[model samples]
Target chain A: MLKLIIENISKTFKDKQAVTGFSAELSEGVYALLGPNGAGKTTLMRMLADILKPTSGRILLDGKDISIMGDHYRDSLGYLPQEFGLYRNFTAVRFLSYFARLKGLDKQEATTRVDEVLKLVNLQQDRKRKLKTYSGGMKRRLGIALALLNDPKILIVDEPTAGLDPQERVRFRNLLSEIAGDRIVLLSTHIVSDIEYIAKEVLLMRQGTLIQRSTSEQLLDSVKDKVWKCTVEQHALPQLQKHYKVGNIQRVETGIEVRIVSDQQPLADAVNVTPTLEDVYLYFFNEEVIDGVQAGML
Target chain B: MYRQECYKIFSKKSIYLVFITIVLLLVYVHQLPTDMTMRESVFEELEETWGGPVTEEKVERARESMNAADAGEVSNHTFELRATDYVQFLVTGAAMQKQDQSERLTMLEAEMHDFDEGTYEHREAAIEHDMLQALDDVHGFYLIRSWREMFELIEPTTHVLLLSILIFLGLSPVFADEYTNRTTDLILATKHGKTKLVSAKLLASLSYIVIVFLSLQIINSFLNLLKFGGIAGWDAPIQGISSGLDSLSRLSYDGSPYNFDVWQFFLLTIALQLFASIAVGVIVLLLSFLTKNTMITFFVSSIIIATPALLQQLGTTDGFLGYLTDFSFLKLMQVSTLFTQFQAYNLFDYPVLYPYLLFILFAVVTGLLIMLTYRLFRNQQISH
Candidate 1:
């Protein structure tokens, strides 16, 4: 089986340590890298993709250092950067074919792979359109298609669903699940729902450190009984939020139904609720809450 | 892969616009004066009857034609004018050339006596003496007005400048575009990205330079042919003829150190120009790799490529700046200056000609720049 060992990797930019002492071993499954902004998820991903070298430690693929392996390592690697740009002048087919050649595919193979990936991404109909004309969702799909052009053994995608609509995001998540068989797919994103069903393990990072690595179920278990639900008047909701980590808030005829994460019940009528990846996310990153609510509430 | 890189460069609409500008520049700059065109045609007509070797009999023939025209025996006054000019060129021109070469040799030899035997100055004089001595074997002068005009117009300054602009604008984006587009992460993660990709880009750039250089050259040659009527006397010694135009007089290969025939000298200038263009191109690539901003790369490259020519124009040809200018890309493209006289640099008591040094220096620079560009681009981190 293919295995990518990310050793104690750290990256520093001048006075700032972007990624600090992060380590993980990946093999044959979707590993979701979840973190807040400036948590160094992109930095660690960049190092794993071999686009940036770590300030310390080394990354190895099957025991060989990836830096030393160079192109040999990249031969089986595919990466989609978070804020990537495309050659606006190139058509989808041409862009895929260009990257295919760079990935060491011959002319016929590049042609075949280009067509296959275009079809896989459901972009075959618009394959002839210039990338500049592609919509945001279509461009994201094309980016994924480019990563899969080589059918890489190691796929690293950072914020792949940022601009994708909900339907596109679900389609992408399903696509990632279907393609994760026998391949290491490292997915980094803020959308917990994207990885809830597909992720074999979720890696949580904060301030350039990988704080937790566990399955979605196990992570939810950590926040079990910590999540509570109760209805409160609109005016009292602010006081309730101040004492607990508030998640999703809903409006009801009776009052405001709020989900809160706390070690103890915050209200006399509060009932313990089942935890979700979003609750677990809030529980772990509760310090990021403002005005008693999570900044990016699901 | 190579084809793809070439496509990237040639596919740009901006390159085509640059080419259009170049063609327009060539046309505007190389326009031949109306009188020169008339004189060239008259000389061609005169060559029909008087086109043989330059001898006393031929001189007498031309004299007779002029006298006849004065007596109204000849129909065309233009024909008379050409005949008179031809006689003066055939008789007085050769005698004056010989006297000038002798006087120059005397002056140089006397100057040589002032320097120590093993010094660079002494060696320089000795080299010029040898170059001047080679002119003794010149067979004879001929009706080479067309060839002379062609040689005199082989000014590569504007062509090189236009070429630098093309390369600067076209290639400054070669590596910088990858970074600007944020495609570096995707590309660097590919199999051939680090190795063959660099090679492909470099080869494509060099091919572009060659094709562009040839296009500019073909346009120049065509314009020169149209301006000078036609290229003739290819086999005539470069020392055989001189232009009457004040602007072209300095380019009169009459006292050139090299004994190249007209065609040989023409080809040499073109070869030197192509070399300098490619050298400038490689330097531009290095700049592209260093500064990942196309505008910055283009700006700095313009400064680097234009400074030498600017300095030369400002009369910085005597001190340290002069030494730098002598070996600059502009100087190499100014092929006529290198060959018009015997110019050399002293290397460990050995004299090396400017052309040889030009090739050696730029070749080394090209090689090193290629390596540096490759290393920088290949090893660059895509943090941004």
Candidate 2:
């Protein structure tokens, strides 16, 4: 019965608009906010977190304005910002207890919850260690543990896997997938593969606007038969890149090989290939390459 | 929640370091007046002056010799008399306050001797005869006691200075650290972040102030007892050991109305001082809540706490300007000022006196500051 509806949301900085006329209604599922740098994913998540008041919009939790709901709204909401610093002197367990108290948990309950989250994040052994001694990945896991302290019905995590290693990222991805069944988990990331197989819905944003919303397969199916593989001479690669949206580029034994998204074949020898979430992402957000790195790569 | 906040403050070594430094300074400052007490040689000097350890007979003989016309001129200066061992302790210390006002003291003593129809006291007595009526019973043969002179004149200033520094350190981080630590987003998103958590932090800071104030009070009182002898005559009249007296029984005319003994006045001074000290803590917290920067809060708070004493030093301490200092935050810290019955101010059409008016002003301001601290801390946005 949990619902969050964001309507006509816009955030304008002094000179530029960070998010504009964005709207969405979310129930319970793992919803991925996929975008390139400066796509307003963090801005949107911050608004939902209720830390940043919107310039214009209403975020309704179960049909009541979240701003008026206040503590009632905060009780059910858990947020992990893109970057936050832990109080350096506090041991992990003490820090968790501080957050639990803020969440209105009593001492006995906070202690139990702290132990539970520490174990869930695989930091139970290191609970007594000072946060300054924790590795970056361990700190990232600690952030996730804090976000889970309330067992919030609506969880908002911005760039949750940013500092984690590949192994830790996989573990986190699986963890989020398991926790998303009953909560409205809004996960924002630029990594297409992180949520490719896990998210129930993928929200594609470009230039501060939601360009597309679809199921994982449906997002890929939109570009089906439109992605093709072609090989060309190394000297002709730049020319080929200009005509089509290139996703994966690799060196071949003969000519250079490239996978691209185009409505029709660009060459007589081009063959259709199944599209990845990455290919779809490149088609939508990587049309303009910068500094020889594609937007999706960034 | 309060215990959790207490843990945050108590677990920090920096707070403990500050507390220890202040306590050591207290021990050193409290030990300062020990040599001024009754040493064996000082008592011997009294024996030499009066031909024996001072009994009433010998004291009368010494007074006769000093007042005799043949007595050698004492340099137009009021030299210390060979008082009883304990009274000698009070007189030597009381001389320091006279030393601060020697220019005025000499003028007043000369005026007392003139006794002309146009003399300042004669004219003042005629103008405010009713106010001056109480001097009818004020007469000869003065008595003396320690009067908390050694402790009041010295310790209260040291107490205020050290207490302000400690309060600034304890409260400057009450709200500002959340900004520096980047814990604002997490806290602002919590259910009790704006209300209950802020209340807990303030309660913790205030609890610290009260504990430090009471500890310093008890320690300073005990030290005064050991260093200057017990306040056995603490209940004696202010006239007993008052500085710059015109007659044996004549104390400060302004203080005459209250008729409070030194102990009673000292108790009131302690109450006013503790209120002002805690108010200082509130000022630091309010500044920290607004600026969200601890360094700015400390330096600014220090400037405010120091300005009053500096102004009293630079400005005239007699007329309108002196009366003005009674209302200052630092002026109350000097407990000796509370015994000066010479000044009264017209506050709100009622003649309010020092120490009493100061207490009311501090209570009002501290209450406002508490509300302001809560409002600013709760409403501030963590947009960064």
Give the residue spans of candidate 2 off by over 4 A. A238-244, A262-268, A287-298, B32-35, B38-62, B68-81, B85-157, B238-257, B310-328, B332-339, B342-344
lDDT at B297, model 2 = 91
lDDT of 2 by residue, A1-298 (tens): 8789999899888888888989999999899999888888988988898888788988999899998998889999889998888888889998999999999898899999999999989999999999999999999999999999999999999999988999989988999889999999999987778999889899888777888889999989998988999888899888887777877888989878989888889889999999998888887776545434655577
Q: Candidate 1: where are CA atoms >4 Å away? A: A289-298, B28-32, B38-79, B106-118, B136-141, B145-154, B246-250
- The pairs that clash in candidate 2 are B254-B341, B254-B342, B255-B341
Per-model chain A TM: 0.96, 0.93
Q: Output DockQ, candidate 1.
A: 0.77
TM-score of candidate 1 versus the correct structure, residues matched by position:
0.91
User: Each candidate: how many clashes?
Assistant: 0, 3
- Clash count (model 2, backbone only): 3
lDDT of 2 at A174: 92
- Model 2 chain A lDDT-worst window of ten: A287-296
